[model samples]
Target chain A: MTEFIPPATRWHTLPSPFAMKRGGELRDARMAYETWGTLNAARDNAVLIVTGLSPDAHAASNEGNPEPGWWDAMVGPGKPIDTDRWFVICVNSLGSCKGSTGPASVNPATGTRYGLAFPELSVEDGANAAFEVVKSLGVDTLACLVGNSMGGMVALAYLLLHPDSARAHINISGSARALPFSIAIRSLQREAIRLDPNWNHGDYDDDTQYPEAGMRMARKLGVITYRSALEWDGRFGRVRLDSDRREDEEPFGLEFEVESYLEGHARRFVRHFDPNCYLYLSRSMDWFDLAEYGDGDVEAGLRRIRVDRALAIGVKTDILFPLQQQEEVADGLRAAGADTEFLPLPSPQGHDAFLVDIARFGPAVRNFLSSL
Target chain B: MTEFIPPATRWHTLPSPFAMKRGGELRDARMAYETWGTLNAARDNAVLIVTGLSPDAHAASNEGNPEPGWWDAMVGPGKPIDTDRWFVICVNSLGSCKGSTGPASVNPATGTRYGLAFPELSVEDGANAAFEVVKSLGVDTLACLVGNSMGGMVALAYLLLHPDSARAHINISGSARALPFSIAIRSLQREAIRLDPNWNHGDYDDDTQYPEAGMRMARKLGVITYRSALEWDGRFGRVRLDSDRREDEEPFGLEFEVESYLEGHARRFVRHFDPNCYLYLSRSMDWFDLAEYGDGDVEAGLRRIRVDRALAIGVKTDILFPLQQQEEVADGLRAAGADTEFLPLPSPQGHDAFLVDIARFGPAVRNFLSSL
Candidate 1:
C-alpha cells in the first residue's frame, strides 16, 4: 500500500476525457481534493467527505491555508470524522468553479470557456468522479462515505452507480431525489441568471461580473430558504440593520437586520462562485433521481446499494430534505435488507442545520460511524 | 341615504388632490368601485370588499365585464358574502392600475406617467382612499369590511385610521405589521424589477411593458411561496408539462406543470399590471405598521381598532402569513376587549387558499358575518 501522507491540496487529471452518464463529456477533466490525517497501511482507513453545491475541497484548514474550513468545527484532530484515526478526503464537486473542471474551464475542443456548452451534468457523474479520486488515492475500500446536501445525494448516487464499491454510506440532510419543490427553487435561480440582460447568454467575458444583480437575488432566496423563519424571527424581529436610519423612515439600503445578513453572505458568495458553474451544478441537482437506479422502484434502487451498513441523518427543520425524505431513505434501505441507522436531529437552521448547528448534528454522524 | 341600486362600475374622484398619509399625492385621485345587491334603506347595510394587489373593482362579474371576477368562486348572488341580502362594494386600491388613479395615470404636474415620481405610499393611504369612496357613495355605516392579502392590511388600517367606520372587520391573510420574513420576500420582488436593465428606472412607457422579464421572475417566486409544497407534490409531482420531450431530458420551455402554471399566471399578470404600481403597493405594505397606531405597541394597535366584532382567518399551510401571525391578530383583538373569533382553516392552498379553495375557506367568513 502507498504510504499515507495527508495532502493539503492536490489535483488529478483523468487519463482520458471524462464521459458523462447523461450526455456529453469533459475534456481535460480534473479533480481537486484535500485530505487530513494519515491513511493506514491497510488502505481501508479512508473516509470520503463530499460537499454541497458551493463548498470547495478546503473543508478544513491545513498547512496550506491556516483559515478554518467550512466544517472546521466538525472535522478536526479529535472531533467527529477524526483525522487522527482515519484519512478524510473532501473533493470539490465536478462542474464547480472552486478548483474543479467546470464551465469556467477551457474547452479542449474550441479552447474557449465552456459556458452554456457544458454538458448536462448529473449527480451520478459527480459520484463517478469521486470514485476515480478514491482510486487514484490508492484506497480500495472506504471506511465510510459522508455526504451533506448535494454531496449526500452524490454519495447515494455513488452507492447505486457503483454497487459494492463502498463499505458504508452516510447521507445527511439529503433525499433520494430532488423533489419538484426543490426543482422549482433551482429553476428560478437559473432563470434569474438567464434573464439578466448582462448575462449575454452566459458568454459574459472581459473579466466583467455579468448578472451580479440577478445572482445576488438568487442567493438571497437561497439564504432565506436555508434557514427557517423561526430562526430569523428569533434572531432579528424588525431589528434595523443600520441604526442611523430614522425609525419610521424607509431607505433604499436594507432595513431589517436579516436583509443585511442575507446581502452580506450573498455578496461574498457572488465574489467567489461563477454564474455558469452555478447554473450547471444547480440543474444537475434538479436532474438527480436515484429511482432510475431501480428502474422507477425506489426500494429496488435501495437494494442495489450494496454496503455493509448505511445511515441517513435528517433535521426536523430541514425543509429542503425534510425528515420524511430521510425516513424514506432508511425505510428503503431497511426494506432492501441493509443494516441502516436512521437518526433525526431537530434544529432551527432548516436545510442548513448540518453546517450551522454542527454540535447537534455531529454526534449522530460520529456515533453512527463509530458503531461501524 | 342614497337609493339602494347596485351600479355597475363607477369612478369617484376625491374633492381635492389626494395626499398620502406618509407623503406624496395623486393628482385627480379617483377610485373605481363596483357594487352588488341593493343597499338597504339604512346605509348601515353596506359591506365593503377591498381587494389584494393586482386585482381591480371587478371582484365579481358585472355587465361591463361579463367574465367571472377573480373572486367569483367566493362572492356572488348567493355566495359567501351573500350579495342578495347585503350591498357589497369592491374598490380598486389607490395605487393599482386596473381603474384607479395610479402610477400609470398621467401626473398632472409633469404630464407624464407618474412612474417612480409617485410619492411614497402606505397601506393607510389605501384605506383612507377607500373611506373617501364609501363617503362619496353616501354610506355612513358599514355592516362589515372584508379584505384579503394587502387588502387585509388596509382594512386593519381603515379600522384604526377611521376608527369605528367599519362595524366589523375581517382580515384574511393579513397581519397587523409586515413580518421580517414577508419584508425580505417583498424586498427581493422589488429588486427583481429594479435590476432589469430594460426597466429604465420605471420610466418605460408609450404602450410598452417595461421589465416584463423581471416581473415574470418575481411572480414565479411569488407563486412558489404562495402555496404549500405538499399541494404541488400532490397535484403536479414533477409531471411533465409537455409529454413529447424525452422522459430523462430537460427542455428550455417549462417541463413541470407547476412551472407552466406559474408562468401562465405571471404572463397574465405582466400583461395587466404596471411595474411601478407593483413597486408602490408592495412598498406600501412594507411600510404599513398597525403598531404605529398604538405607538409601536401591537396589542395597542389591536385596541385602537374600534370594532364591535372581528374575525381573522388563517390558512394552516400559508407561508406568506403563517398561522402564527393570524393567531397574533386574534390574540391581540381579545386582549383589546373586542369580541373576536379566530378561525384556523386547514387547506393545502396556503396563503392563496382564500382565492383557490373557496369551498374550504368561505364558511368561516360566511358564518362570522352571519353571526354579526
Candidate 2:
C-alpha cells in the first residue's frame, strides 16, 4: 500500500472527524489538488475539475512539475480549459492513490496503512471531500464545475447534496447511475484483483507482493472497453507482432499487434496505481446511483440538481459510458429548467475520447466554458 | 486434462501421422461427432454443423443421447435444420475438451495428456479434420455447411482448403478473419487463465490443481461478451443480489444480480472445459486470417471459395463479432458469385444470439437450409 504523489500536488486538510457517507469517520484526512492561473478578486472565476478514476491532481504541467499530465492537451494555459482566462483547480478523488487520502494512505491514529480497513467508499464521499476543498479555498460558489467519467457521478452528487455549489456544470461521459453492464465490468475487474494470490485480501506489500498479474489483466480489460472496435480495426487491424517482438516460448503470449499493445499499456499502468486504492475507487463508482436521491428514478434525481447552465458531452463510440448516459444527464438537467447542451461527438476512441481525441472535444469544451 | 465426452459422441480416426497446419503431427488422432439423421441414398442431404469453442458434438437429443444438447432447439426433428429431412452432423471442434482430440487428450506415444505439447491449432486444422470426418462418413458433400461463431471461421477455411466440399454455406455470427477487438478480448481471457498460480503452464491436474479461479475469470469474460449490454440492462438492470447471496466477508464479492449471474455461469463452465484446450481453441480463432490466402486481401480470399449459395447471419448488438464482420463475409461471398443473403438480425443477445435467440435465429437458419 503506497501513494504516488506528483511533484506539483498540494494538500488540503479535511475538517477533523469528517464523517463518510457510508458510515465511517476519518480523523485527519486530506485531499490532493493542483491549480492553474490566478483567482479573480471576486472569487467567481474559480473552475473546479473533478477527475476520472486513475488521474492525479496534476492535470497538466505547472510551475513545480514540467512533465505533462494526463489531460495536458486539454488543460494547459491556452488549451480547451483556457487556464489563462479562468482559475482552474483539479482535485484527485478521495479514494484514489494519487496524493489523496485513500486505502494507500496511512491512518493517523494507528500510523499504519488503512488498506481493507478503509471505509466502504461512495461517490458522495468524494463529492463531499471536493466540496470541502472548495469551501476551504473560500469560494462560496464555483463559476463552473467540470467532471469526466467517474467525476461526472461525483459532480452530480456534489450539486444534489450541496445546493447552489456551482453555477454551471460540464459532465463528460458520466452517468447518473451505475448500469448493470458497467457494474458487471467493474465487478469483474475487482474480482480479477481479489483472485490474485499476491492481493492477499488487500494485505500485500507494495514492494514484495504486488498483484502485478491481476492489475495487468484488469488494465487490459479496461483498455479494451476504453476504445472502440472501429478504432482498433482502423489502427491495428489483424496485424501480427514481428518475429523479434514475439515470445515464442510462451505459447499464449502476444501474437497480434493489438495484444502486444495491450500488454505494453497494462504493464505501464499496473505498478503506478495501487491495487487497494483502485478497488475502493472502482467499487465506489459501481455503487453510485443518483436514483437513490429520487426514490429510484435516475432522471428525477438529476432534476434535483440546481445548476443554472450545463453541458453534457459524450463520444458515440464509448461503450463503458455510452452516449445515452450523457444524454440522460442533459435531459435531467434540462427538465430541471437549466439551459443544457448535450453533444455526442463522433470519436472512434470510445470512452477515452475525452482524453485522446482533442480535435472534436477541444472546441466543445472550450465553447461550453466560454459560454459559462 | 480429462476430456468430457457426451454419450452420443462417435469417433472417426484421422489418417495416421495427421499433420497440423502449423508444423506438427498427431498420431492415431480422432474426431468426435454425432449424427441426427441417416444419410440419404444419394448422400446429398447431409448438413454438417460445426460449433463454437466450448460446445460438444451432441447438438441435439437423439436415441443414443436423451439429453438436450447446446443447439437442441434448432437441430432436432422438424426444427430449423430438420434432422428428419437433412442428415445433420455436428462435430466437436478439434481443440475443444468436448470429446475431441485436444490438449486434454492423451498423446499416443507419450501416454500422457498433450496439454501444451499439443500442436498449435488453427481454424484451418479444425476445418480439415471436419472434412476428414465428412469423407469417412462416405458423404460427397451435397447439402449445406452450417457454422456458428468460431465454427463459421472453420467452415470458411474448410470451404477454402477443400474446394467444392459443400454446395452452400450458412455462416452465423462469424468473421472471415480475427479482428483486433476480438483478439484483444481473447488475449485477456488467455492471460487470465495463464496468470492463475494453479494453471502451472498448462500442467495442472483435473481435481486438486485445476485453475478454477483462472477459468472462472475467463468464462466470466466470455459470458460478458457473448451477450449484449442491452440484454444485460433489460435482464439484470441495477438489481442488487440479496444479502444472503452476497459474500459480505469478501470486500469485492458479488453485489449486483449481473455479477451473481456471471459468477454462477462461469462456475458452471470452468470445470467442464479444460484450460489448455480453451487456450488452444481461442488462439486458433485469433490466428485465423482469410487474408492470408489472398495477398493480404480478405475479400479476395473469400472469392476463391466455390460455394453455390451462402448466408451470413449476425446480431446487431453483438460486440465480439459485430454485425459488420458478417456483412464483410456476405459481401465477399457475393463477389465470389454466390447467391448470398446477408441477414443482419436485430437480436439483442450479441455474439451468442444464434445459440439463445432462437425466435430470430431459427427462422433464418431454416430458410437458408431449406433454400439449399
Candidate 3:
C-alpha cells in the first residue's frame, strides 16, 4: 500500500484559508510538519501525532538528524508508534513559537510581528491547521490520531468537528474541558508574565529581553504542577544545592535541589519560548468547551465523536486531567457508538506520565496500534 | 483557684538578656501577647496559644478590641478554648512583624531596621520568646499548648526544648520538619518577592509601597496551597467573574472566580504583612528540623519532649502537611513513652482547615482540653 510520501520536513499552505473558530481568519496560513515512513496508495497508513503545550514538529528521531525526538522512546523504528510500519506526521501547532505561523510570525496585515494583535486562537483552529497539513500530504482518512495533554484536546476538536476523519484516536491525560484548578494555575502563570514591568502588555521592544523573569516564574510554576509532589518529595527532599557555597555569604543563588531543578527547566524554556504566544495559547486552552459544541450537554458532546476506534489513557496522579476525565472520554466515545479502550496507568509522574512513562504507557499504546 | 488575670493586650520585655538558639541576643527583647480569663492561684491553669505564619497576638475578640480576631470563633470566652475556665494567652512569634520585633524592628546596634541584618531565627527562638512571655506573666506551668500549621512546628520545638513547661501539647496540621513540597512552594514565594524589581534586596524605601505586586502573587500562591484544588473545583470551577467586564478589554484584573478569591486575600495580606518578615519566617519554617534537637534521631527528638500528654490533629485533605507527617508525630511521641492521641479528620480545606473548619476541629480541641 506504500505510495505517495511527503518530504521528510516541509510546510503546507492552506488550500483556501483558515477560518478561526472565534471570529478571525488567517490568510496564507502555513503549517510546519515532518513525516516518517511512506503513505499508502489508499493513504490509510498515516498516523497523526499532536504534541503538548511546549513541543514542536519533532516527535521521533529520523535519518535527517540522529538526535532523539521529544517522544523518541515512544515513536521510532520499533517504538510504540512504529514509524517502520506507520507513516507518522507531527505538526508544530498554530500559535506556537516553533517553526509555525504564530504570534512570532510577521503579520501579513501589518508586515510586523503580530504581537498582541494576533487573533484569538482556539483548539479547533489548531486542529483545522493540522488537518490541512495532513490533507496536503495526501493522507485521506488518518489511521490513528494520537495526542497527549493539550494535544489530546486538539485531537478531540478534530474528531468532533470532522466526525469521520480519523480511523482511531488515542487521548492521553486530556480533558473535555480545562478544570478550574488547572485554569487557576494557568492564570497565575499569565499574571506572572504580565506583572513583569518589561512585558509592556506583550509589546516589548525587539532590543530588550522579553519578560524573562515572568516567563521564568511561569515555567517554574508549570514544572511544579506538571509533576506530582510525591515524585519530588523522595527525589529532592530538603537536600541543599551547593554544599560549598558558604551559607553565610548572603544567600542569593538556588538553595534547595528542587529550586535548582525548577530553575534549570525554567531558564531553558524562557530562552526559547515567546511570552505573547504562551498567553494566547494558554487562553485558548481555557476557552475550550466541548459541551458547548453539544449544545450544553456532555453526553451529547461525546456522542458527536464518531471515530471507528479510540483509546483514552489517563494517569491516576494526573492533577491537570484526572482519570475521571479519561473515563468521560471513554463514556463519550461509547455513547457515540465507537469501540473504545480506557487505560488507567498509575505513576508518580502525574500529568507528565505520558511524556516519560515508557514501560507502562508504551506497551499499551503499541498493543492498541497493533490491534487497530 | 482563679486570680490575677493578665491584661488583655500588652507587651512584656524580658528583665534579663534574651538568648537566641543560633546566636546573638536581643538586648531589649520584647514579646507582644494577648490574654483572656483568670489564672489559677497555683498558675497551673494557664493555656498558651501559638499562632501560624501570619496571625498576631489577637486570637479572639478581647477587651482592647471588641471586633472578632482571626480565631474568634474557636477561642471566645465560652468557645472551644473556653476562656471562662482557663487563662488563654496568644503570643506573636519572634520573626513575625505583627505586634512583635522582626525584620521591621530597629536594631539597637545600628539604629536602623533589622532587615537582612536580623540575627538568624529558628523555630526554637520563637518558642523561647513565647516561653519567656508566659514565664514573665507569673506562670509556673501551662495547662496546655495549642498550635496549628507553623504554630504546630513551634509547639514541638517548645515541648522538646523545655520538657516540663506545659502539661499537654496539641499539634494541628504540622510536621517535625518542612517537607520538600512545602519547601519548594516557600522557595517560589520568596523568589516572587525578590524578583520584583521594586524589592531592592529587602532594602526598599519605607515611604513607598513595599513590593505589593510580588507579595500579592506570593499570597495568592499561598491561598491556593492552603486549600485543596477539589475545594476550588466545586466552588469556583471555570466560572467567569464580572460578565460586565468586556471580553475585548485588557485582562489585567481577575477573570476567574478562583482568581478573584485569591486576589482578594492576597491584596488584604500584602497591605498588612511585611515582605522581609515573610521571607525570614518562611525560611525559618524550612530550616526547622526536630532531628537536629534529638542528636539526629526523630525518636530521640520526641523523647526530649517531657510533656505529660499530647494530641496531633491532621486534616486528610491537607497537602502541605499530609496525614503521614501527623502520624510521624504520634509515632514519635508514643516511641518516647508520652501519652498521645492522633486524630485524622476529613475536610475540603487543605492546610487552612484548622483556621476555618471549626465544626470539625473545634470539638476535638475542647475535648482534649477538658480531658487534660
- Highest lDDT among the candidates is held by which one? 2
Error at A160, model 1, angstroms = 0.9
**lDDT by residue (tens digit), candidate 1, A44-100:** 889999999988898888777677888988887888888888899999998887777
Q: Tens-digit lDDT track for model 1 on B137-169?
A: 889878999989888888988887886797887
Q: Is candidate 2 or candidate 3 better by lDDT?
A: 2
Task: Candidate 1: list runs displaced more than 4 Å.
Answer: A1-7, A243-253, B1-8, B243-253
Residue-wise lDDT of candidate 3 within B119-149, one digit each (tens)? 7788888998998899988987899988888
DockQ values for all predictions?
0.54, 0.89, 0.58
Docking class of 1: medium
In candidate 3, stretches whose alpha carbon ends up further than 4 angstroms from where it belongs are A1-9, A245-252, B1-8, B207-209, B245-248, B251-253
* Alpha-carbon RMSD of each model: 4.4, 0.9, 4.5
Clashing pairs in 1: none
Ranking by DockQ: 2, 3, 1
- TM-score, one value per model: 0.94, 0.99, 0.94
| Number of clashing pairs per prediction, in order | 0, 0, 0
State candidate 1's TM-score: 0.94
Off by over 4 Å in 2: none
Per-residue lDDT of candidate 3, residues A140-230 (tens digit): 7899999888998899998888867899999998878877778877888889998998888878765375788888888988888888877
